[model samples]
Target: MNFKKIIVSAVAIAAFAGFTGAASAAIREVNEWGASAQFLYWSAQAPNYLQNIGCYNGGWTKTGPTSKYQVSVGTCANGDTFIFRVGEKSSFDGPLSVMGSTTDPNRGSIDPQEGCGDANPRQRLMTDETTCSGASCTARKCVDITVGASDVEGESFTQVSHGMKYGPSTATNNVWIDRAFSAIDTSSLANTRKLVVPFGEFVNNTVTKNGVTIDNLTRHQVVQIYSGQAWYWQDFGGDYTSLPITRCFRHAGSGTHATLDKTVMHSPWGGALLTDESLVDPLTWFNDSSSDLMKCINTIDGAIGYADADQIQKVGAGQTYPNVSAVKYNGVMPTRATIANGEYDNHWAVQNCYYRPTDAEAAAVCNAVKNVPSSKAGFWATTCEMTYMKDKDWTYPVYVGATCEAGPSCSDGLDNDFDGSADAADTDCQ
Candidate 1:
C-alpha cells in the first residue's frame, strides 16, 4: 500500500561507487522478481519487515508495470534502494508448445534468433534497475521505473494465444518451488474469473433472444471456446451476438493462465489441451499484468480472458470495465464463499514465496506475505481462513482442521485442550 514516491537525484557512478565501497560494499540487498504485484507488495509493505530485509525506510514505491515483471522498491537507512520484488517467470515453467512457422513467424519478426519461435521470439525477462550504475544510480534518480517499456532483456509480448494456458504456480510446473529452494507456500488469496473486453459484451450469456437462453461458459464450454471448438457467440446456446470469439490469455509464464489450464481446460486431470495455437488458429490476445489484461479486455469485443477474481471484479462499476457483463462458470460465481467452499477453483493458487539469500529470513518474509490482512490485501483469503483444501488445483475439496464440526474457533489442526487429535476426531466435529 506504500506507493510513496522517493525523489532521488542521480549521482555520478564513480563517486557513489567509492562511497559504497568505503561504507556498504559488503551488503547485497534483497531483490525479488516473480508473479503477482499484489502478492509481492504484501511482503514489501509488511509492518516491521523492511529492517529484516536490510531495508529501513519501511516505505515502498511501485514501478509502473511490466510485460512480465514489475518492481516495488524499498529504501534502507543508508539512502540505498533495493529491488524488493519483481514478478517471477517460473524459470520457463511447463512446456513451450510452439508450432513450426512459415513466412509469418514471430521469431523472425524480432531478430530471427531472439524471440520465441513460437510466440514472440524476442520475449524478455521482467527485471529492471535504477537508470544507471548502482554505486550512484540513486543520485541520478532514486528510483527510475519504466512499466511496459522494453527492457532489452525481456521477451516480446506480442503473441497470439491458442487458449493454451501458460504456466501453473506449482513447483512441479514452476520447478523453482521445489524443496531444494527456500520457498513459502502461501495459499491462494482469491479465485480468478472469466473476463470479456469491449465492456459489457457478455451482458450475461442469457441476453434472452427468441425465448432461448445463452448461458455463461461451463468448465466444458470454457475449454470448447478456448480451443476453437466453439467459435462464435451463438456457439454456446443462443444467438446473442454475431461476434466471433477471440480468446485472450496471459502471455506465457503467467500463473493465472496456468491455473485456467489446470482447473478448467484440463479439469480433474481430465485430458490434454490443444497445444498448437495453429490447430485452433483462433483469434487471440495476450497481456502482461492484471491491469493490462483488463485494459485489453475492456477495449476489444469478442475478447475473453481470465485474471484473479479480486483483480477482475474489484473495479468500480462504470469506473473501469464499464460495459462488461458478469459471466459465470458452471452456474456458480467466483465469490469468496464459492472459492473457499470449492465451487469455483479455477482462479485460486497457493501464493508461494521464494527467496535466494537464505531460508530463515525467507520464512519470515513468506510468513508476512501469507499473513497480510484480507481487508488490506483486497479479495484474498488468509491462508488458513478457508474451510477446505484441495489435493490438486480443481480436485475435490477435503475438510482440513475439521473438529467434528465447522466452527469459527477451531482450524488448521488447532488443539485447544492439548489433545493430539485435532480435526474430525475433536469434539467440535463430533
Candidate 2:
C-alpha cells in the first residue's frame, strides 16, 4: 500500500468533515467558512468550552449516527463562530498546518500544505478575503481551536510525526485539556473472552470458549490484527460470522490512530510491531472522525479499532453507541480506577490546544477551554489524581502513591483494606 495516499485521504476526508451535510438550522454555520483549524484533538468537548467561554452553538450538534458524535458549531461569546470538526483530522492537520510543511514532497511546495501541492483551501485560509490558490499561496491565518478533549492528544500525533518524546507536547501551538484512549472492538462479548496470549502462529485457529474452542483477543492478538497477521474473526477463535477482519482505523494523522500505533503496534510492551500504519492499508478501513469510526465498527461484524473512551459513553438524542464496545486489554479494562493506577495504561493520552498565535480569536477560544478544569468534564486524566506516573508513552508506569491498592497491594497476603480477607480473597483486591 502506498503510504502517501493514506495521508492524502486523511486531508481530503478532513476537508469533507461530517458537517457539510448537517440538517440542523440552529447549528448552521455563520463563519462563511474561514480557514478552519487544520488540527483539533477533541471535537466532542469543544462545543461546551466554546459555548461557556462563548461560541453560541457551542453545544449544538450537527446530526450524525448519534448527536453526541456529531460536529458542533456555535456563536461564541466573542461573537465569532468556529466549527471544530469531529474525528481524526484534528491530530493529523495540526502540525503540518501550523508549521506550514508537508511530509509528501511530490504533493507540492517544500512546506506546501502537507505535500498536497497547494495549501488546503479550508485548512489555512483564515479570512474570506482570498482563497488559497494562484502561483504562490498566501500563508494561512492559523485559527486556534482550544478544546477540553478526551482520549488522544494532538501533541501525541506530533510526537509520532516528529519522533519526539511523548511527555511534553512537541506542538506547543496546541493547548490541551485531558483524555484517555481506549482499545475498542465490535462486540461487548469480546470483553468477556478469557485473556490469553498466543504462543505460536495459527494457535488462534483452535482456541474456544464454554468447553469449546475459540480464539481470545489478548493484547498480542490485537497487535496481530492491526499488523495484518490475523485477517478474520475465525483466525482468532471469535464466533463472529464475518470473515476477513475489518480493521477500522482513524486516518494516518489522527492522534487516536498515532496513539494506537504506540499503544499496540510499536508499543514498548509488545510483539509484532506495525511498522507503518499505511503498510496494512490493504486490510484496513479508515474514518476521519471518532463518530464515523463508531459507525464503521457498528456496521461491520469482526471489526476492531480504538478511540476516545469518553465519547463511547456519550448519548445523543436518546441514541447511544450501539454494537460498538470497548474491550479489556490483558484482562484489565480502561476505567478511571485502572488507568490512573497504571493497571490499564496503554493508550492513555494527554490532550492540548492547537491554534495559530497570530489569530487572536483562536487564542481567545483556547483560553476559554483552559478555564474549565479537566475534573469538571469527567475522566480527563488529571495527573494529580493518578497513583502511577510515566515519562513517555510505550513505557510502563511507576507507582507514584499508595492511595490505590488495585495494582500491587492487592496481592500482599495481609488485609490491605481492613475488611478481613486479604490478597485475592478480598473484594477490594478483586
Candidate 3:
C-alpha cells in the first residue's frame, strides 16, 4: 500500500478550559480486514486530551457474542485537526466500533466529511489470530495490532548527525608496552653495589635506595651521559668509575620514550642537553631491534636501558636474556612502592596515558578499559589507576604492583628472591 501522511491541527483560544463536549462523537473507518490503518483531521477547536487505543486494549466491549478479533483506532492531531482510522483484520469476525473526540466536539471532525466522499472509508485494523482448543471447546483469539506511520526518515537523520559529531578519528597514536621483566629474578639483585642509571636530575644522588631499585640518580645520570653532557659517572656524585658509562633507553616512538623525554630530558633539564635536536631521530635511540637498546644493555657490562617495569621483571625471570641493570637514581631505588608513593620519584617519568579516538569514542573506550581484565590488558595498562594524568586534580601517577619494601635492601643489586646475581643480572626479580 502507498504510504500516506497524516496531519492533525487545532485552533487555540486565550481562555484555558477543560474539554466540555460528548466524550465520543467522530467515528470513521479508514481501512478493512488484513489492511493498514490511516486517518487525518483538522478542526477550528483542538481537543484537550487525545487517546488512541489499539485492539490490544480489549477492542469493542459491545454487548454481543465474543468474536475472533476486532478493529482499533489510530489518531493524528495537533492543535486543531483530529483524524482517526479504524479497521479490522481478516481474522476478526465480530462487529467493530470506532470512536473519537475533541475538547470541542462541536467544532472538530474525526473523519473529515469532505475528504472521504459519499462512501465512508473503511479502516482496516491489523490483527494477529491463533487458534487453541481444549477438551471442553475450540476457539480463536484475535489480537489487535496496527502498523503506524513511519518516522524512520526523521530518526535516520538524527542518528547520522549524532554519529558525525561523535565518531572516532584516526589521528591518535597507539603504543604497546611489553612485560619483559616479569620472568626475571628481581630479588637476587638486592643490596648489590651495581651502577645506577638516572633518567634526569629528578633522580639524583640524594634519593633513597633499596636493592634492585632503579634509583632516581641512575635514571637522571643516563640522560645526562647519553646526551653527552655528563662525561663521567663522578660528575653526578657516583664513584668515579674509570669505565665509560653505558646508556640504555627506550626505543623511539614508545610511550616509555615519551615519558623519559618529558620527565628527565625535557622538563627537569629544560631540554638543554637531550633536546629533539640531539636525539633528532627517536627511532635511532630506541626501537624493536635487538641490536638496539636492549641488545646494547645485555652485551655491554656497563650498559643500561629503560623499558616497562613488566619487561624488567620478565628479564629477571629468564624468559629473555638478562638485558640491563636497574639503576639507582639519586640514591633512591625505583621500587614499585617508590613509584606508588612518589618517594623514589624517578618512576614518575613514565606514564600509561590513554586518549579517546574522539569525544564519543572516548566514552566507549573508557568504558571498555574499565571493564577489561587486567591480565589481558598487560602490566602497564591503566586498569589499576583511576585518574588520568592529563585530567584536572589528578595528583598521582598510576602505580603497578611493584614494591621494594618487602625487606629487600635496594643497594645490594642481589636478587633477593634468591634466583640469581645482582640487579639486572637476576633472571627472576627484575
Candidate 4:
C-alpha cells in the first residue's frame, strides 16, 4: 500500500467529515466567529497538548499517526482551527521570527526540503518537520500560530521583554506560545505582555542512565557528576566500579540544558552560573539532542545525561531507548505525580503560551484558538499525566502563578498536603 496516498486520503476524509456536519453543529463554527490560532511550543509534553486537542470531546479528530513530535491540526465546534508546531525544548531559542529574515528565509523557517526529504507529509510533521511552504503546509490553512525550537520554557523573560517593553510590534510577530515560554523575571515584563500566558507544569531536566543499577542520587550527587567532581561510578554507587562516569549535556541553546543549569547548577534565581567550570572537561562531555543522548547512554557505559522527564518516559514507552531509564533524584522517581505535585525538586520551567500582547488581531486569533469548546479547562496530555500517575483527572489551565506553595498557610488545617485534608492536615503539609 502506498503510505503517502493513504495519509493524504486520511487527512482529506477527516477535514471533509469536520465540515460536513458529521462532526456536529458545535464543530461547524463560522469563520467570522473566530480566526484560527497557531502555536509554536517547545516542551516535551507539547504533543500531549496537541493530541488532546484532537481527542477533546470528539469534536476534533487527530488524523496523523502518533509520534513523539508531530504537528497537529484540529477543527473546533465554532469552525475555529488550531495548528500546533512543536520542537525539542532545548532548541527553542526564541520566536521563529527571531531567526528568519528576507535575506535568509530558511534561517528560522522549517524547510520541508531539508527536514522532510524522505518522509511523507504526515511523517514529516510528526518527526519535527512540522512546517512547510505554500499549500504543502496543510496543518492549518492560515498561519495563525508559529513556534521556535528547543525549550521555549528555558528562555528567560529577559530575551523577549525588550521587544514587548516599548510597545507592540509594528507587524504581526506570527508566533504564539502554545505552552507558554518560561520567563526568568515575570515582574520585569510589562503588564501589557498579557498574551504571554502560562499554562501547565512539567518536570524537565531529568537525569537518565543505562539500565545499569545505581544508587538513588541526591541533587548534590547529580551536581557532583556533571561538575566533574565525581569521576568513578563508585563515587555515585553505580555497578561500574572502575568505569569513569561520562558526562553528557544538551546544547547551550537547548531549554533542557538551560533548565538543568538553572535548576541543578545555577543559583536559585539563575543570575549566576554555578558549575565548577574548570573541572568540566569539554573533551569528555557529550552534547546533542535527547535522542542522541539516549544513544550515548546506550553505547557508553557509566554515561549519564539529562533530558525532560516526559521525553524520557515517552522514549522508554516506545522502547526506543531500552537501555536507558530515568534516574531517581533524592530517592524520588520523576513521575507525573512527583512533577505535578512539585515533589520532584529539579522541576523544569512552567510552559507558557507566548503571543503578541498588543496585537489585537493576533490576540483574537490566539484566544479563539485556545478557547475552543471543552478546551477551556483540560487537554488529553494533562489527562495522560493524571492517568500515568494514577491520580484524579486534571486540567491544563492557563498559567497564573505558583502551583507549588509554601509558608504558614501551607501548613494550615486545609488540604495543604493535597490529600483532601478536610480537617487534620498531614504532617507533610508542614
TM-score of each: 0.55, 0.49, 0.34, 0.48
lDDT tens digits by residue: candidate 3, 281-344? 2211233322244554555443445654434443433635453444455565544444434455
Clashes of each: 44, 30, 112, 27
> What does the lDDT read for residue 189 in candidate 3?
14
1 or 4, which is superior by lDDT? 1
Candidate 1 has a TM-score of: 0.55
What global local distance difference test value does model 2 have? 0.40
- The deviation in Å at residue 281 for candidate 3 is 18
lDDT of each: 0.40, 0.40, 0.27, 0.35
Residues 1-430, candidate 4, lDDT per residue (tens digit)? 1000001123334444434454434321111100011112222123333333342232222322222233434554445454444332233423332222233222232333223322221122232224443323324222222322223332342111001110111325322221222332222211111111111111112332353355366677666666666777666544345566666544343445555655556543323322211223321333334555555565555566766554443444356666565656777656545544445564344333333343332223223221111221111112222211211011123323332222113324555325556424443222
RMSD of 3: 29.5
Residue 380 accuracy (lDDT) in model 4: 13
Model 4's alpha-carbon lDDT is: 0.35
Model 1, residue 201: distance off in Å is 13
